[model samples]
Target: SKFGTIYFWRVHYNDSSDHVNETFSFRPVQPGGGGGGMGGA
Candidate 1:
């Protein structure tokens, strides 16, 4: 990864439920930058 680079990531829940629901999220990070989209500016 280099500066100015961008990336994406997400997570899912695989469970057996009558109303199975899951949420996916991603936080891109600037190459050489710290922290994910969690609180990136």
Candidate 2:
């Protein structure tokens, strides 16, 4: 798996007219990417 990567998802409806949509994002962490493991190395 990759690290420090971001992913997004969205949905669209209708034929270029009125539509509903939503957006979301997230990132992956390597257990202790911020601290703890390996002295935050």
Indicate which candidate wins on lDDT.
1
**Where does candidate 2 have its weakest 10-residue lDDT segment?**
4-13
Q: Relative to the true structure, how large is the alpha-carbon lDDT of every model? A: 0.30, 0.24
Report how far residue 31 has shifted in candidate 2, in Å: 10
For model 2, residues 1-41, the per-residue Cα lDDT tens digits are: 22222111112122223232221112223332332332322
Best by TM-score: 1
Off by over 4 Å in 1: 1-29, 35-39
Native RMSD of candidate 1 (Å): 8.9
lDDT of 1 by residue, 1-41 (tens): 42322322222223223222321122234333344432442
Ten-residue region with minimum lDDT total, candidate 1: 18-27
Candidate 2 residue 10 C-alpha distance from true site, Å: 36
